[model samples]
Target: GGDNLKAAIFSAGFKEGCILLPLLGARAEVAFGPAGLGDLYVTSTSPFGRNRTMGEKLGTGKNLEE
Candidate 1:
């Protein structure tokens, strides 16, 4: 999903850049809500991002609270 979106952004002439997830999350929270922009962050970093990985692990039955 991010790949496709990245390709679109690239084709549209936006240079690729990496903004740390927490910072992005913070800005999004300010704009969106206290719950944070979880979907936007996850989808933006999907497939290999730490947040995405954590979400995947949790989704697959791994427990973070041990």
Candidate 2:
């Protein structure tokens, strides 16, 4: 049960990150240029679930503690 819980948490986090990262990158590209996409492809492949979540929240104008 503990392992399942951990897996579920990881899954949810990754899903949210994967969803937000691209959308935000698209917005950046629109506002700036192709470089706005930045290292999206590279970052998305890394095991940075928590980092991605943080980025998503910041990108959406939400507080990190939120």
Candidate 3:
């Protein structure tokens, strides 16, 4: 899935450097579970959004009580 996304980005003419952070962010989610998702939220282009906030809280051991 990530590989396909990467290929698409490259096909779109984006250089490796431009997409490295995003790929790494995606890898975090695939490799680290919720904690990785949190990291992805912070590291990806979109930061401090609702999903990111939730991921961060969950990564910090917060339960989804609500």
Candidate 4:
């Protein structure tokens, strides 16, 4: 679907951006943080982010690590 494709593009953009934005924040934090992202949190760039949708999957018994 066109809409799904567009949504995936946006999602990837956000996750990729998260990979960048926090790295440029500082040196030490970047070295020690998750994916070198530090404690800086990247919120969903859209309401349709997978993390947001995970709530439903969790309701179905999916673990956070899944």
What TM-score fits each model? Answer: 0.33, 0.38, 0.30, 0.36
lDDT of 1 at 3: 83
lDDT of 3 by residue, 1-66 (tens): 597875575444334433564566654224334444344434443566667667778999998984
User: Which tens-of-lDDT digit does each residue in 1-66 have in candidate 4?
Assistant: 587886677667646655675577744444345533222222233455555577667889999888
Over 4 Å off, model 3: 1-43
In terms of lDDT, model 1 sits at 0.52
RMSD of each: 9.7, 9.4, 11.6, 9.3
* Candidate with the larger lDDT of 1 and 4: 4
lDDT comparing candidate 3 with the true structure = 0.53
- At residue 4, candidate 3 shows an lDDT of 82
Question: How many clashes (backbone N, Cα, C below 3 Å) per candidate?
Answer: 0, 0, 0, 0
Clashes in predicted model 2: 0
Ranking by TM-score: 2, 4, 1, 3
Query: Model 4, residue 7: displacement in angstroms?
Result: 0.4
Give the number of the best model, judged by TM-score. 2
The residue-by-residue lDDT of candidate 2 on 2-66, one tens digit each, is 87876676566555555675677644233233332223333444556556667878899999679
What digit string (tens of lDDT, one per residue) describes model 1 on residues 1-66? 478877675444322122343455544334334233444455454687666778778999999972
Checking candidate 4 for backbone clashes, the offending pairs are none
Angstrom error of the Cα, residue 13, model 4: value is 0.2
